[model samples]
Target: MTATDDKTVVREYFNATGFDRWQRIYGDGEVNKVQLDIRKGHQQTVDTLMGWLEADGNLAGLSCCDAGCGVGSLTIPLAQAGAQVYASDISAKMVEEARQRAEVALEGKNLPTFEVKDLEELAGRYHTVICLDVLIHYPQDKVQGMISHLGSLAESRLIMSFAPKTLFYSALKKVGEFFPGPSKTTRAYLHREADIVKALEAEGWRIERRTLTKTQFYFSRMLEAVKDQ
Candidate 1:
């Protein structure tokens, strides 16, 4: 399929029931069960990301974008930390749920604006732009274009996460495909670290740090990169 076609399928799939079901499941305190063995290091991952943001110190008054900001998991925290965040998702239901969660999570505090949008429609540059766990929806060949678009949307830094590629990881992904309870979308792509780095390099992005979170179901790798001006 062409990149446009793949994006359309991804957009449709996320809008259907996948995103809402995931939000319902994870938002209801089932993250531990759904994630199984990886629960122990969840806070560490968040802490590490927060540490990265804090290191720059420029995050205090920066405008940020959380692309594919599912259920406000990362969006709420960024807003609470004082970033002017704009969060968006392909799923309208997911956006609504995220808005509700932000209302409760932020309470009287300033919260990020949430909207229904896909990565392709995202515009403008941000001090920091985050797209986590969203790359799986794109095919491998199109990841470079997507990464380029994401990199262009960031003025200084771009943070992203993807399912790591390895022989064992591929096996696990295949297993998930077979035993899926919900997410049954075809053509989800798992990415290799080297390939991802190459994609970033093509768009003049320099990787500053990367974190690998290992789990039974999947392995997630988070990266922080700076655009070469």
Candidate 2:
């Protein structure tokens, strides 16, 4: 599918059923075993990313863009940690939900600016750009352009996560196709790590840190990339 076509599908899904499903997974709520596992796995990724960010020193006054800041999961924490955060997502519902959550979490304090924006529409430079678990929506053919666009917007670092393509994971994903669930509603694309690294290198970035989070139902390869000096 074309980039526009891909964006439309993502916006539609997250604005509807995807919003509800992820809200539950990211929230402190009752969920099925699979979803609970997914929640744990996602939190691990977020924690790993936070560690990498904080290790660079104080987040105070740092500018950040949470490229797919679904429901303020990372946005709220970053704001609380004193980062100037601008968060965006393709789903209006997700953005609205994140805004509401941020309002409550920040208690009228430092709150992130939230926008409903497709990744391609994002502009301006930031100290760091984070796009987590969002790349699963993009196929290999379109990944390079997206990576370059994101890289251009980050003055210092770009952190991203994607479903890893491998024989084991690919087999698992194929098996998942047989089960009836939300997984069937929209296409999920897995990407090779080497391809991701190549894309980052092409944009003049180098991997600084990396981690893999996996569970029975969730998998993500998260990495931090720094601008090559």
Candidate 3:
């Protein structure tokens, strides 16, 4: 698909289902298997991110940019932890919902900067740049550019996650598409780990840590890379 098509598909898909994901996260609704699987996967990602952020030290005084921060999963929590956060997503509705959620979730804190923006539109450097579960939207050919762009926005650490490319994982995602109802699926890309590493390395970032988070029906390869001084 062309870039425009990819954007349209992703925006539409998230616009429709992003709230469902949010509600499921808060135990607000009954979720189907696909939604439940995604929720489970994201929970792992958020927990992992929090641990990494704690290890990075001094959360109350750090700068963070959470690109593709769907419904404030990571954004609100980061802001609550006392970091100044700039958060963005491709879906306008998602951004709005995130703002609303943050207003309620972070009542006493300075709200995170939330905007509807594509990956390329995000600007500025931060102590840490975290983009989780969003790389699955980009195909292989575009992954490096995304990685490089995100890496450039990080002064210290960059954390990202992608649906991993493996014989079983690739086939699993494909089979998932077939099993989900027509309205329940969107374009999903599985990326090679080697290529992601190469992209970060070229940008003068080295992987500090990596892990594979596997839930019942979801798989994500999460990496934390630090810009080499």
Candidate 4:
């Protein structure tokens, strides 16, 4: 599919029940293997980001933008971590859900501003910008551009996660695509770590840390990159 077609599929997939179901998995505290594995991987990535953010300096006054802030998972925590957060998502439904969750999580105080925006459309720079798990929806060619855009938005740091490319993992994903299940998703793209780093470097960023999480059903490479002044 073309980039536009992939974007449409991603928009529709997250707008439907599939999105809600994933939210439930993220919220339900992992009742099944898929949920359990995904939760394990997702939490690890979030923790890695948070750790890097804190290590960078005080979080209380820094501005953070969470691109593809799914259901307020990272957005809520980032706000709670004492950062001013601006959260956006390509899916309208996701932005709405994230706004609602942030309201509830913050006890009716909306600390993190929420909006429906895509990576390509996100504007403004912050001390740090994070785009997690969202890269799986982008093809290889597009991933680099998105990474560059994200890099440009961060004055100091950019944290992101992607399904890492490896022959074995790619083969597994391809084989699994043949059989559809309840949580079946739109086409996912796996990217090489080197390619992502090169994209970041092109935008004047350097990786400070890297973390990988792998489970029976989940996998991701989390990188914390700091921009060069």
**lDDT of each prediction vs. the true structure?**
0.78, 0.88, 0.82, 0.83
- C-alpha TM-score for every candidate: 0.87, 0.96, 0.92, 0.93
In the range 1-229, model 1's lDDT, one tens digit per residue, is: 7877876776676677666556654454655454433433444555678788878787677899999987777788888888899999988878888899888988958888888998989998788898887888787877888898988889888888887788977886677731245665647688898999999987888999999876444467899998666
lDDT of 4 by residue, 1-229 (tens): 8999888888888899768777776775537666666777788788777877777679987899999998888899888878999999888988888888888888865479888877899999898898899888898899778887888788888888999999978888888832235666688788999999998888888888898988777889998888667
Candidate 3 matches the true fold with a TM-score of 0.92
Pairs with steric clashes in candidate 1 = none
Model 4, stretches more than 4 Å misplaced?
Answer: 177-180
User: In model 2, which residue pairs have backbone atoms overlapping below 3 Å?
Assistant: none
Q: Is candidate 2 or candidate 4 better by TM-score?
A: 2
TM-score of 1: 0.87
Top TM-score prediction, candidate number:
2
lDDT of 3 by residue, 1-229 (tens): 8877888888887788744555565444688877677677778888888887887679996999999987888998898888999999998878888899899998857899988999989999899999988887888888888888888888989999988888887776667742244555557788889989998888888899999888766688999998666
Sort by TM-score, top down from the best:
2, 4, 3, 1
Q: What is the descending lDDT order?
A: 2, 4, 3, 1
